[model samples]
Target: MRITAENFIKHLKKNREEALQYVIDEYIGIVKAIIYNALKSYNDPQIIEECISDTFLGAYENAKQFKGDKEDFRKWICTIAKYKAITKQRKLSKAPFFYEIDETGNAVKSAEDEYLIKSSTEELLMMMSQLEQLDRDIFTMKYFLNMKNEEIAEHCGLTKAAINNRLYRGKKRLQQIHLGGSMS
Candidate 1:
């Protein structure tokens, strides 16, 4: 049978196993990208894979609630993926040994904490703006892209030493900006 969002939803709700294959084929890429954007910083493939599975499982479990409209599939799955990713991120952010039991009682951060993280990210991006373009690019690749120095060096056709120098100087400059010191 042809797969439509309506048909897919019906099969899923009815617990027809083959419907999963259709959903995976149709939606896995978008689901994965959403998860990746959320979990990029952690760099854990296992966590990423688990979140993707959870997202699908969530859709299956909630299939009855969905109207089974194909037009709504993308948005619905995206919402599920976003929440699943956030949940996984919160779980990974809390380290068992880092905090006392009482302090770690709530692993999930409040919405305000999420806002602060966003603000901090914006501030850091703004700080990076003070550096020369090459310095900024190098810094982003190393930190945001989480590329190894050797990988970045190869990409930029520079030596590993060059990458390190730019990172050090860029950091110092950003620090100076933050400290309100005269640029050296």
Candidate 2:
């Protein structure tokens, strides 16, 4: 019996290895993209790759609980990838740092410096969460991913001017929140 999209869920529930392979073949790109986007600051390819694997493993293990069709499965896998990457990020932040020597023989990023950077990033993300979903996504793409306004516009299906306007307003809102003012 061959596995098709229509029967994917049924096969997955049976714990068929082919079903897992089918999912990997079909959705690896989406999984990797979500993991990479979530872990962009890590600068460690190995960790990102590990998170991708973990996401697949999670989906396979949790297959019985999944409902809905192929489109839902794509969303489910993406959600798994996102949470796995976040878990990896949190674990990395809590782990101790080892000093690495640069070409000039100077150590890069003291433990304290790393902690400060991680904490500040967490704070920024918390503030970003207070934004409307679209504004939050635009802010993340523009600032965290370092994507250009044109690219963000294209990705978001908005005009560059709209992207600019949203960014401006989002910044103002963040500033107000930072200054102990409530979001209006």
Q: Pick the candidate with the highest lDDT.
A: 2
lDDT of each: 0.72, 0.76
lDDT of predicted model 1:
0.72
Per residue, candidate 2 scores C-alpha lDDT tens digits across 1-184 of: 7888898889988999999989998999988988888888888898888888888887888787666578657755765666567667766765445556688874566677656654554455456557776886677567645689999999989999999999999999999877879867
> Over all chains combined, what TM-score does candidate 1 have?
0.51
RMSD of 1: 12.6
Q: Report the lDDT tens digits of candidate 1 across residue range 1-184.
A: 6666557777877866678778888999988998899898888898899989988887776666554267555656666676677666655666354333455474445577556644554455456556775776677567644589999999889999999988888888898988888576
Candidate 2: pairs in clash: none
**Cα misplacement distance, residue 55 of candidate 2 (Å):** 0.3
Runs of candidate 1 with Cα error greater than 4 angstroms are 1-6, 97-184
